[model samples]
Target: MFRFAMLTLVAAVSAVGAAQAVVALDPVRGATALAAVWREGAPPPQVQDRAAILKSADGHYWAEGEIQGRPVRFLVDTGATTVALTQEDARRLGYDTEALVYGQKVLTAAGEARAAVVKLPAVSIAGASVSDVDAMIVEKGLETSLLGMSYLGRLSGFEATRTSLVLQP
Candidate 1:
């Protein structure tokens, strides 16, 4: 089942050179596909500039990234308009959470939440990188930090398969 899903995803991604279509799967199929991908996931060998493959994790695509010279974990989330972070995660990434000015109202599963806008110097995933990213610090209702369009929209393209997500810088 997992292998089949991976192959399906790979074929879809390769066809368009972007995974935007893969993410459209219904929740159950999406989750299954993600699990299969992560089970066999590994970073691409012989790293190339602005190109890399990321495997899914648990039911989501995750990546080890850097912000402000500190390592950070990111949950790839295209649904999110901008990079959204928990205050705790922001602090860990060296952002002065206490100094942040929360002024934006955003909707979350938990209800309305406030967010603080901030600029990230740079964020790198595997060998590809993007700079001057716009992000938001949500004080609550968010369980994980997300790498959203603020970063993804900057990419030349990205593709997804049941087994992996390919990023083009």
Candidate 2:
């Protein structure tokens, strides 16, 4: 009777293992069924590091980012070396434009201008964030804030298509 009970237990374990194998091999079972069998009815979690930005009519990529929990618009400029903020935008974000020393001279589309270098505590775009980003406050000749390489370089990758830009973090 003891040998018979052991044999029955082994057979029962083998049956359960074979059922799982069949569930894994069967295409009709699908992922939902497989999840039910393997994960106690919980679906697999998805984790992706991608954000897409649609191109504007003016043939530029624009992104809306947050600095200190406040929204700021930026023209994505791959040619720019660091994130450049307009003096107005800087002021809106609580920076005192008059007090900041404009010691950095940089070239803009309009002409050469002086800028103040500042480190942002954090900048977030489309759920991706970078902390302690180096940025500049252009004193003049900047119509729009720029999202430049300082932030983009920290990302894993980015690509531009005809209609959109995809950012990989």
Candidate 3:
């Protein structure tokens, strides 16, 4: 009976450790603790170094990010091959739009638009940063700044769910 009880205890401990291991690997580490409370009716676990989580509203995941060391809101877009900025956003980031050479013709959802291709000194999101990123400044017809592969591609990984997006830096 003693031996059987010891084996059961070992199995229980292993199972608990496995659960924590799985949670540790999650992109949004805080979600693990939140999920534990939601799933197992336990208290929320203390989370450290949690990943930034963005919830989708209106079918888009928006995030707060930094570009050129300035705060900007981003529309996380995996479809975009490179980061795209609106003329106003570029100005907000202290770019001289009048001097920007709009020589690149790029096709957009709004048809053909002339864009200025520029190398960003650095782009950071959720503490992960990439320097010398290629980005395009759309002079017209684009509403929001896009956080594209130029930035997202630098991360170790990111995960998307139906209602939320997790950025791992």
Candidate 4:
């Protein structure tokens, strides 16, 4: 019984642990097709992890502990209208670029930039979850991941008090 329970628990966690980020394939296909694809072959698995990014330590950020285990660096940028990712990060996430739907123009600190809008299956940050997140595929050089209003705004809100900005989300 103990062994069965442990095995069940492991199976459950493994099945849903990654569900925080769900990918939706357009024009849904039947399970048969999906099974066929799986039986044949598919791309490599993407590394997923979760870690903390802190400021008290210095102007430091770590890419390890992202919500779904994807590498990410958090940045506080009000100038940005949305949480954004560099192209490198997108590549790290297995975005299936061939299926990407191109989108609009954006103005960046550097200058006007062309960005392809892609909906992240899901983006989990600081225990806060948001799905169908609108993110820009950064085309230029960026210092860190832009934690803009799109994701932050969905959270309760942020307020600065003395030493640190209190992020309620």
lDDT of each: 0.60, 0.62, 0.57, 0.43
Candidate 4: residue pairs that collide? 48-69, 49-69, 50-65, 51-65
lDDT score of model 1? 0.60
**In model 1, which residue pairs have backbone atoms overlapping below 3 Å?**
9-161, 9-162, 18-159, 19-158, 19-159, 19-160, 37-163
Model 2 worst lDDT run, 10 consecutive residues: 32-41
Give the lDDT of residue 28 in candidate 1: 45
Clashing pairs in 2: none
lDDT per residue as tens, model 2, 30-136: 32101001111111122276776666554445677789888887766554557888888899999999999987766555656778889999988776688889888
Residue 141 of model 4 has an lDDT of 38
TM-scores for every predicted model: 0.69, 0.69, 0.66, 0.54
Candidate 1: misplaced stretches above 4 Å?
1-47
What is candidate 2's TM-score against the reference? 0.69
Q: What tens-digit string does per-residue lDDT give for candidate 4 at 1-169?
A: 3345324423432343211111112234521100000000111122233222233333211222153468565544333346666566777787654555544444444444445677676676544556667666655534345555566456555443222333444
Who is ahead in TM-score, 1 or 4? 1
List model 1 lDDT by residue over 26-89, tens digit each.
3344321111011124545324654555554444466667787777667665544577777777
Give per-residue lDDT, candidate 4, residue 44. Answer: 16
